[model samples]
Target: MPSHHTPYAINVRGLTKSFGGRRAVDALSFTVRPGRITGFLGPNGAGKTTTLRMLLGLVRPTSGAALIGEHRYEDLPAPARTVGALLEADGFHPGRTGRDHLRTYAPALGADDRRVDEVLAQVGLDEDAARRTVRGYSLGMRQRLGIAAALLPDPPVLICDEPTNGLDPEGIRWLRGLLRERADRGHTVLVSSHLLAEMQQIVDSVVIIDKGRVVYDGDVAAVGEPTVRVRALDGARLAAALTAAGAVVEDAGDGVLRVRAAGAEQIARTALREQIVVTELVGEEHSLEELFFSLTEPGAGQAPATIQETAQ
Candidate 1:
């Protein structure tokens, strides 16, 4: 039996999964520390779902291990009590009421009927909403029900895949707060999503993958430095001058150059000194979305030429 007091950290080491001749995940490795929300991010075909399924023991890995604390998911004595996972939103029977669906799992998970009611409320599915069959529920409602089921056990580790899929703006905000609060209370949380913009607002750290491989693994804030975007009369000349002045310049098209290692004032002064007519110059913060594309987009650095076409 697993100890309740033990800290749970999701550790994936050299994890790989192959389908036929193609690899869905190749030598991927990362750690989801306790008391933090680690975003498992990638584009649509980047093996994010396959990786999460392997972590939950629904899919077997071809190599390496995905462990919570010291035990693989299947080896955990009371998995539901230790880890609550929401991998599929439409997993419930279409005829079952939301509250009844949760109640059905209660016995197997060792949770009581009261827990069903608590979780339903926690996810904002009211009594009326809970009584309706899942077939009649909207996508957002089903998403809430899935979250409610995951929360029923009040486990130490929570794993959710695309929890924000069907949420409205307000619901998305609520989920962000909920996950952050869960981690703040010392639980390990790993949430997978393909949308970089949504994950950017919540994750403490990120593990981005592409072509079934780990492209980046680190603090979200450390990927790129702040930069300034400048557009001038002679774009090539301005870029060259900025490059010579110890700034890394990237052509952003339309006569614009993204200049790093310099602020707006520095870029303005440099343009003036170089006798270049500046059209637009402003400080631009690089978003996680931008960094994600830079590392995972096709033809970009470190990404493969082939996109995953089957079973990713």
Candidate 2:
């Protein structure tokens, strides 16, 4: 594990990028704090990769700032020591073994062969796997090798783009644990992914974009309000009972009612009071997947205007 006396937060303010006549990222701004994992999410062509490239100083931003702490990535005294990034897994040379590839980058990061071995084991790339040529490696193996390279320097900040792309369920779990451990050590992590369900379980916060503009940026729990799901023998009667009780109820088809502004206990009591037989009653929170669709769906418009202004 690596330790940092002062961890840096990732900050982007009014960050904009345009290619040709079209805008890729428009006035995007957000902060990713140390000791937490922030999910950078969007649909295809939403400029997630563009934003990440700008953050790493790979592709220059047309306007605004992308700062790692107070300095831009290229301005960092030792960029590799400050931030380790995995932008793409296929950036490797096909003929080089994983260990050799890491060794080649070690000198620049002031790391030794021993550190390389440590990172390889950390990412579950055993010695045998490390010695094989990249061309012979599986997609999952390549992903792990990329991660190992990122961790070789034990940098305080990490940025990854779609890191779970080729991972199996078990591999995904391993990556989650690895990221959690880094954050627990007070390291900053910004990960971009389309795996909304898996992200809901791993990330502390999320920044969702649509059409290259921020739609939602906040804690995952705050994305949407919790609702109560209830099924009754008489669907019409239950709907009326819940409505009279001041709960906004919707007929969710097949005798199921989705009730908002109320809890399972309240719904149950209301049904009992009205002599309505309750067959099923469960309290559920809106899932990350649901929230993503609601914000990005056509005609969904943008999230509340205040979210873009006050997201930090």
Candidate 3:
């Protein structure tokens, strides 16, 4: 569905932003729905940060607009009450304890102390650490604190940029689990990250931007065609069988071949006709890392990648 008419959790229409006479976001438009984790993905300079800044009302847009429900972020009387953001630049005070920092934002959003402790625990931060100064908190702990602050208001929508930065493998896994849990609870989660390998398993949908334009936006799995690996004795004989069956097979050399334009069943049927014994038949799951490269690479261009945007 079009972001213009859809009632997604987050909506942007013709959202454009500029920096130093360069278009960071150009006529960008998309929607993020509740109960799903939408990935905000792009390369290092792919306008992900600028677009997010505009959505959170941190950076004024050069043109266009974004809205959280019917209200613009800046126009909302209490932003944190409706939308929680965890941008890379946003964090707690170094001198203040993790618990105290949340307390400061709580009353501002009319949140109670009891709710504060609950959210801290929800994000896996120890409430006992409330007395400890933030200066001693590790990068992972600080991230947990940021998530706690975002959850404190019990907002329906969340916007987080590079939340797993500076985190170890374990911490990254923990953060992914937390985000998935929030989405499962009907919270709309928007996460932007350059690391596609890490984000793939969690995000339900994705909106990928490139060179100030949306390259592909769709179900992460549906972005690429299924890949298959084939192995057999007498590679040439097998390829000939596939070709005779109206399939395209390219000889990749070294007894290896790349099969396209045909599926496993067809290839198997053809191989049986030629009396070729197949050694292995496997389907390749296109990983997020591979998909990202194919979508953004030079020769691949914009044609092969398909963008599917729908609202629930």
Candidate 4:
């Protein structure tokens, strides 16, 4: 088991990376705090991978800085002991057995065979599976091997890019538990993925990007407020009343109104005061997927206000 230690925070400030005339990451800025899972999300073409590479010192940024705590990746005294990353699951020699693959990195990380065996079991890779060559492993198995490698050092910070890509539901659930356990033990975790639904269940905070820039950054719960769905015979009157009462009301057609900034009780009170007939009323909270689409979809206009800004 990894010992508890103060985790290092990840910080990116105006981090930009460009290829030819195109920018992959544009002035990206966000912080991944210690002891929490921060999801780095975006659409297919968003700069998530590039930004992560820059943070790991694998890719040079066109400008700006990506740091681990107060030092850059290259400046870390013992890189493996400070940060363990699983950027690519397929980064393995085809002929190498899973155990050998881990052994190759273990020496450099000051880990022994026992540590290697521990991590292999930690990732659910049994001794039999560990003895198999990478060429014969399934995608999910490969992913587990990669995770085992990352865990070999028991680093304070973990960065996994789409770590759940090839995992089954059970595997995903196991991975979530492992990550949550790490965070609970004071390890910083940064995960980048398009699986919003799964990430919503795993991450405490989210940093959503679009077109190489941050669209939203803060607590996952703060992505959107809970909304009330109401249907009234006097739709127009109710909408007018709700709007006047400081609610943002949207027409859901068929005399139904989707409302925010007001609770069901308040809506009922307003309808009663106006003597309107109510047909249906339900409270709904926007899912992470819905929030992601709203921010990254075309014609999204300006990004919604962040939690920090809303508090001000």
TM-score of each: 0.79, 0.82, 0.78, 0.85
Whole-model lDDT, candidate 1?
Answer: 0.84
Most TM-score-accurate candidate: 4
lDDT by residue (47-108, candidate 3, tens digit) is: 88888888888899888888887678988766767788888634567899888899898888
Give the Å shift of residue 49 in candidate 3.
0.7
Candidate 3 lDDT for residue 162: 86
Better of 1 and 3 by TM-score: 1
Clashing pairs in 2: none
Superposition error at 189 for model 4 (Å): 0.5
Q: In each prediction, how many residue pairs overlap at the backbone (N, C-alpha, C within less than 3 A)?
A: 0, 0, 0, 0
lDDT of 1 by residue, 230-286 (tens): 888998998888789887787877777878777889888888998999988788776
Q: Which window of ten consecutive residues has the lowest lDDT sum in model 3?
A: 303-312
Which ranges in model 1 have alpha carbons more than 4 Å from their true place? 1-5, 223-225, 228-282, 303-312
How high is the lDDT of residue 298 in model 4?
Answer: 91
Candidate scoring better on lDDT of 2 and 4: 4
Residue pair clashes in candidate 3: none
Cα error, residue 85 of model 3, in Å, equals 0.6
